[model samples]
Target: MESRPSVARPFYSTFADLYDHVVTDPVGPWTEAVEGALASRGVERGTLLDAGCGTGRHAAAFAALGHRVTLLDASAELLAVASTRCPGAPAHLGDVRDPHLPGSFDVLTCRGVLNDLLGDADRDAAVRSSARLLRPGGMLALDVRDVGRSRERTDDTPRSTTVHRDTGSAVTFTHRSRWEDGLLVVAEEHRERSPDGSVDVQEFTFRMRPWTEQEVHERLGRAGFADVVTGPGVGGRWDRLFVTAVRRA
Candidate 1:
């Protein structure tokens, strides 16, 4: 394995406890898409691996549906949240591309992660490793950002926005974003308030590469996946792209 250049840890680790509240329906949309894909492909009930499963929401959903589930993530804090969410379900703390499992899975999922990768080599490694973790004929489902459409925006200035709300504990979110040189970069600021009026705050910056549909198809094919299919992505959003590929039998 090539040594991947170090990148800052994603927001998942920095604000794990607040993840479910901040991200809109993280698992519901993905689970629905994955279930639909599996049903269409006649795959029902099997070992499922959730790669880059930040809070284990998707894995928990599958486990609830009677499929044995395993989860992998790079963030230990996120993994802790996952373990609590899906008790008894196996979870490992590591990169999705380097999940240490004794055997391959019948189905693998990697949603909402590829676009955030900071390096091209890391992206390629993730694809190859996802392919490696699946049994021949198994399924791989994932989503990607619609980079093609994002490039349509002509604005060069960064956009800034913030949201603050109280639901038991006060929470605040600040975001600044802009597109630059084929990458969408964002600076995120988060603050959580205690009842005593004390506050915890953190800031992180992340970059996501826009991925075209054709580029996605080629990447999966190169990673040894066949019968690749693309369609509308999850979240009922026309912006993202969803794909399902089968490991070459």
Candidate 2:
């Protein structure tokens, strides 16, 4: 398995407690899209692996819908929140590249996890690993930003925004186009701000090999997936490309 440069740890270790406040609301649009994708593919209740699951929100949602859920994340702090929120579900701390996760799942969901890990080799390994975790005929659902859109933005300047609320604070960060080792690097920074004014920032960088919709289809096909579909984001353009692939039997 290929490994990528690791992202900084402060974001996961310290900022995990208040990770949700800074970003767009994921439960409504995000979850709805996930649920719709699964339903459109005829995915019914079954065992699920919430890889890179932050705080178990999606895992809890799956469980509530009658699917047995396993929540795994690289951050222990995030896993702790997941455990508290979904007591019956098992939560594990592990990297997405190699979950060391046991058993095949009926469905696998990974959101905001892929774009964080750097390096194309590592991302490819992670995708293959995710494919391996699925039982034949099972489904894998993940979200990624549309790098294509970024290239078309009018203002070439990177965008940075912050949100501070009574409950929690968050920072939204975007990096301008950068090239490394023949691969395009696009990253976003998210920091959690505490009531006392302490800040914890987590950066997620993606190394895409200039992928088009057709290229994505071909990659999924090579990964042994069938019936691949891409769709617009339920939240915003950030998650504009929602990919769903079913493991081939």
Candidate 3:
């Protein structure tokens, strides 16, 4: 058994390569839902920012649908993968909490990002930064885990999935989550088995705070957003709340 050093790498650094293996959701449904939300506001196609874009799957999907896409992520490794996936689309390395990008967009999508922020100040900063990055009347779509639904679904049981790489190696990923003070603390372990019978393991732990639809709306509204609308599981997960709001003109 080989254990990785305890030194911390950037969040998602080790997970970047294994992202697609763990998150196997097709980009089709995500793009469709985002487009549907933006289209309701008379936005067919325009500059779109995929904030916290992991591996650029959704950005690529949106670009294929004729929308100019930009990708931003804090993890350099993940941003590189996203850049490769969308060669023409500009990619930036920044945090949504205070993205300093110069361009404004007609639409923005932040999926599975806000929940990573554990503090009210950080969450509000992210929301306000998102508004600042959009042009007036631009649409913003995001999703967060529904706190109640997530708690009901979480059993605190460990689940594992294995992926076979073409290099004659296999990686097994396991995770267990528990509720703590309105936060879901997840502990993850990734074990890699080589064809030569050697094994290595890497472990990570993180916390997520799911939001109620009303709380999300209040955050957006406080950040100068208007016309907020929310739905359940637009991204194909019943435990998530999908929300859309427009930057007040």
Candidate 4:
């Protein structure tokens, strides 16, 4: 499969609205890793930019922690959702690989965005661009998966859950994910039933490339980041590869 930059935005646009509900959580494993990494680097509060900020989960968390947060994503629908998450934060509708912002940021976060590129060149461009977006001595915190570990998995993980809010309706979501051709692809079918017998079925597909920690480290180095470190992913073993690096002064 070839890397199609043309389909990246469209692929994300289809399910951008359901991002916060189904994808990332502000207090979830991702937040744990990112927040911990930021804390370790003594980044308690500063200017922060979340590149590819889907629904602004991480951006909102940082903002609540006293950091000035900015959210950026290619899909406008996602940006709209991010607006609700980080109400006053500036949301930019643009690709992270080509971000246009007013000034440099102290911390740049590119989570859950790079692996989707699934191509060496495409992800590299994003990495280089991320370094450029940061000020000297600023840090880039990003994550990827272990493609080799995912490749060995033979069965699809099936998950079913129903979530209910304080009022309105209930949403039952079924998730099915499998690995194909070095890509971890997932399909989510959501069935929402309203009170008045109204039912809506929404389907969303997502794919990410499981990248080794070494590849991520090298990419960061190529982007002029020094003292790169590949920390453990969200879970133990070769699960989530969280890479943190600082722009060389």
lDDT of each: 0.77, 0.73, 0.87, 0.75
What is the clash count of model 4?
1
| Candidate 3 TM-score, C-alpha based | 0.95
Pick out the ten consecutive residues of candidate 2 with the lowest summed lDDT.
1-10
Model 1 lDDT per residue over 1-249, tens place: 112212454356655677776676556887888888888887666999888888887788889888899878878999899999989988888776566677888899887788877687888888999888888888999887788665664244544333344555566766666788788877766666766777776667777886888988888999999889887767765667888998987
List, residue by residue over 1-249, the lDDT tens digit for candidate 2: 122333655446555665665344657666677777788888776898999888887788778878899999988998998999999888888988988988899899888677665565776778788889999989888776555653454243577756555575544444555655544665656655666677665566655543456755776787788999877655765524788899999
RMSD of each: 5.5, 5.9, 1.6, 5.1
Please provide TM-scores, in order, for all candidate models, with all chains considered together. 0.86, 0.76, 0.95, 0.80
| Pairs of residues clashing in candidate 3 | none
Q: What TM value does model 4 have?
A: 0.80
Model 3, span 114-228: residue lDDT tens: 9899999999999999999999999998978999999988888999999887778888988899998889998888888999999989877888999988788899999999999
What is the Å distance of residue 219 in model 2 from its true position? 2.4
Ten contiguous residues minimizing lDDT sum, candidate 3: 3-12
Point to the candidate with the largest lDDT: 3
Off by more than 4 A, model 4: 1-19, 23-44, 152-154, 164-170, 193-204, 235-238
Q: Distance (Å) between predicted and true CA of 157, model 2?
A: 5.9
Model 2, which residues run further than 4 Å from truth? 1-9, 153-211
